[model samples]
Target: MRRPVAVAGAAAALLVALTGCSLGTADAVPGAVRVPTGPAVTPLPIPEVEPSGSAAAVTDPFRRAADGTALPVLERTPGAVFADVTQADLCGPRYSAGVRGERASDAEEAAAAYGVEDSSPYTTDHLVPISLGGSNEVSNLWPQPKEGAFAAAAKDTLEAHLRGLVCQGAVPLETARQALVQDWRAAYDTYTARPLATPSPTAAPTGGDGGVVSGGVCATDGEVVRSPEKQVRLTCRPDAEGVLRWQRRA
Candidate 1:
């Protein structure tokens, strides 16, 4: 049992077994962390973007009204744009080129400028209002919203106020036109100090033929007339001063 040769062989085998175990250290450990190979990675940064309809999102610089309703076609001549609209001017019968059919076409064309489909919600409105010496030229027109603070009814009130101011010499004619064309809704709130009261559009029957002025069918029926001449057929209502002011019946 104590043979030297046998002991030497046993010791050699044990050394070989120990050398074979050196590979076990290269294996992955159960909970050990490993360093990544190649280049280190970094997270990409996020970018901020503005909303499509943000306050400054509007690209059309010319839509300048408080509610973005002031789009003009720009047809004012020096004499025409700034002219004074006296009683004589308002009394002059409207110079119409065609009929209501033509006006509907015109309204369609006007609405197209604002990218608005279905012109039913809008009326072809004047930028420099005709009441304050604005012309019928296309440049003076825009599609006015039918109801709300920026509605035609509200704009009409503003027009009446400006007209009165012009007539009273409280405001210059050019000043009123410029103010309105610049921002009518602003002028409305500033001048009126209140929101525009949009009245329910009076729906009246169309087509009546009689003397337009004296005992006209529209006048008797108290209905608004869509005259073939394309005029704003108006009726006069007396004010507290006993002076008559013309207005649309509906």
Candidate 2:
């Protein structure tokens, strides 16, 4: 959360000129909406890549005890833990494995590698999700339990944030989201059994029409304003320019 939410163009001008909308239901904008469409499905073998240095090698690998050999989950830390079990399985355990779903073939490979009974409990998961721009690589993946892939919401939220950032012209939203997810996964591994405090919601922003607001998303050159009742609106005030935009939070 330290990094600013991709408030594209004129961070300063928008900060002063633009105002936040009240936390209320706005008329839904159909066309103005942009949602994440999963990562590119690439069917390629994960190359043999190590984390850079031996120090990193000793760090989080995100792998579980392979064949009961105590494979740590250090390397698998992605930027975020947004995806649920289903999403992780789609991306595979290693970031590099381009395979999705219950790869019986992968199971066979694991069975051969570990001499396990049927690879039944093992499945792939992406330390970084495709929607977030993570590459399909072995270093970025790890075979987790079928039941442990329940991090879907985290993935969804991160992906949504990335798209909003893209609309604003900040970092390639996809790339940032992927990095963030992978980072979160790594952190989760370190803190898996530890106790952490929950975060409190921040105060909501306030401003705009008696509160009946609409779409106000950011674009490359200017703002695109659409009526809340119809399409998503992007309003670029003379001063605010490209930075200010709004959409009703679901």
Candidate 3:
């Protein structure tokens, strides 16, 4: 709690110093955190992520979490992935009608994939947001819940800082996007200069835990939690078998 509050302040200060945006403002959604920068700090490289310790090899975008779930899993890859971007991409129309239609029609399906009963509270959000060169492909989207530790707002804070870094040319645009896509929570941890929150096998997992929990999770979770005692949260979504596997993400 103490660290993140300070993290929040530092992130806020970083954004203020770099983007000149108010301390806590996000035009898309509001929450600000500081990003690390310096005259010669190189863009952070991809950190090793152990996805599942499975037989299959995994890429940076896909890793096994502590709970042994494959992660950064996409719905499917977009036909056209965005490799180039500018600051202007953030404010444009989010998804094409076709993409929107897919999101709308599959909203419930997306929710079900996570064992959530209803898709209403979970937003059909982009895995890598459009602001940072993410595409509107189904693979790029997921049903992100609005509540819990790594709620939509929390991701927004990371996005705001990353966007600031991109706009300021402090980090390579592609690196920022790739780092987020690889493991957003890891990226958060790296940039914020914090250690991973210790996982509690007995305590429930937070949506923001950035790791999976007991009974093992379906996928590596990236939601960043404020405290270790607070369980990592996952929405009320059902697993592939249609059994509700998770609880209210807190």
Candidate 4:
């Protein structure tokens, strides 16, 4: 009876070892069933990732014109001028004529920069007029509405008027340039209030000595006049005596 018990125990141990080997090699068999020895596993979910190049990630740095004229953002389109450009070049007959070519690419680029979807109603315009020494650079380019109050057509008229003023020595070139950059709408209002008139030899004096005079007593402070000799412009400012006199612009 003792011997039978010991042999039986040895046989039981051998059977347990064979079962462990079979479990390890189960997947290697042609036809085999895998038995789970532990609880089922639940896989963790994968995190969703946002696309790096999505349009929603981009921030638009442009805004509408201050006076709601559908113009470019003032901060971005502060206006730029060519350093080498002179009054003579700007006032020449062939200066602005035929100077610009097809700007389709520039228009597309400006539209993209300003976050414009449909650019059909917009035209890429210079903040300052090319006829007035404005540059062709991107900094001076902006999408101006083709139609609206104070639109591209209105600006064109202002440009022509300002060019005339600069050529006539009535307004300084720098003053016209600054006026356009500061507020084109206001400049238009101020300059266009009166119809443009040609200066006459017998024109009445404007608080000056008599005719077009420079470097002499003047009536109004902050008044500008051109010399009859060389056509050099001068401004009326206060002197040591607190009297307004035509002086060379500093």
Candidate 5:
């Protein structure tokens, strides 16, 4: 009772499945929060709307805080690729752009050489964040320090999107999700390949003792010279004296 057509069709279907599926009105999941339409103020007051009968009722997981809210979580659907949290730069002080991993230290040095203070090495990022159904993941995210950037532009756009849906009455969670998915992909492709405004220079460190000392330098952040020696071996950080002291290696 083996069918070759079934196997071939299944293989063909797999090839077409590149991205994940978004939610829709007819396919709203349980516990989904339906957003309202209107202008979003700083306080971000929640709007009143009737809940869908079949929709699952749970605390609004996508609710953002007034100041620094945690990003929303996007669950993977049956046929879609879930948004990867590992891709986010947790160490950066702002949003997408501040990811030191995204740019090299030499790039920063080049920016400094060009008389640019705190050179911008920001990458486009999701504002509402791709996980929470914010569209144009690329468009939703903008360049700012990954650590310090807020949801200003992204929030404004999201609020407008939500308000429009709410104003029309009976906004479905799935509809919002689809809109966000479409927007993010479009924006992502647009900005991913754009050129940087400031170009990095290819110059080496200027004339100096060349980091390496005669005897050896202490491997630390900030320390003072303990013993007198021509050569010093310096490590990343020493103590808190600002000046690095040298010590012979064993």
Candidate 6:
């Protein structure tokens, strides 16, 4: 049975206030200060996934690289969702601002599962985003690289697009969740008209550019950085010469 939307909305908002984290635009609460908690510890247990093509084979949800490290191994991180989450609760104005609570330990665990020793270049992302009722369970987490053809930023675009569709009643919430869990990149291709080669604006902007200014050279593509003054948000994208520069997000 579906949960009461009013109750769900209240609970979500309380959770966000307690955690100091949000799924909505970072600038949602003006004058809010964010403290940096350093990266997670190294040397965690790496979860093993069943071999592909075996009788009990687990189908991968994301397209993988040659080394099979680009995306999450399905057996280890199949994704999970919250119970009794209704469309009304998700579409509520407070939903995004109220959803977020992925722990540091969970991030470490996800990195270890991916055989990633250094998780600096990755964001421990929710396979099913919290805005869409994704749980904080380890199974719903994956270490998504911040840069690549279908990187974390690109996935963020898909998430936003899917959420918009669901909220607009163009797509059902369950269908959107299933699509994300099945194969996010494919879902992105089907639901969004944007090209994969293009760098999409991230759902949230973070600070700390290491002194990178707007239009300055940045280290990674699809990286978003806010100005030191906390005024303008910039994203790193390749130019005509394939040089990555921090440009104002479109």
lDDT of 6 by residue, 1-250 (tens): 4569888989999989987888574545777788985323222123343445634224434446344435566677777777767788887755656666888998898878767788788888988888787877888899888987778878886776677667666778888887777667777778765322323234223335554666566655566767887568787654432344567864
TM-score for candidate 3, please give it. 0.43
Mind giving the per-residue lDDT tens digits that candidate 1 earns over 1-250?
Answer: 6699899988877976876644335556679888765222121112222223547537542344545554342322111232334544432344112211225666566667667777787777766665655655444556766866567877776776565555444566667776776556778766554222222223223234333432222221113444554465665322212122334554
lDDT of 3: 0.49
TM-score of each: 0.46, 0.28, 0.43, 0.52, 0.18, 0.54
**Global lDDT of each model?**
0.50, 0.38, 0.49, 0.63, 0.32, 0.67
lDDT of 5 by residue, 1-250 (tens): 4699899878766755642343232455779997884222121112333343333224432222334332322221111212332222211223223222213444343333233355344433333433333333112323323343343344333433342232233344344444433343333233222221211211212113433442233333223332323434433221111122232322
lDDT of 6 at 250: 43
The stretch of ten residues in a row with the least summed lDDT in candidate 4 is 39-48
**Candidate 3 stretches greater than 4 Å from native:** 1-49, 53-71, 74-80, 84-103, 106-109, 112-115, 192-250
Off by over 4 Å in 1: 1-102, 193-250
Ranking by TM-score: 6, 4, 1, 3, 2, 5
lDDT of 3 by residue, 139-179 (tens): 56666657766567666656655654555445666676777
Model 2's TM-score against the true structure: 0.28
Q: Candidate 2 lDDT, tens digit per residue, 42-121?
A: 32222233344435334433342222222324423222322332333323333324434434564354334334455556
lDDT of 5 at 168: 32
Task: Write down the TM-score for model 6.
Answer: 0.54
What is candidate 4's lDDT per residue for 33-104, written digit by digit as tens?
A: 788643221221222222235353355333333454554555456667766677877766567674564267
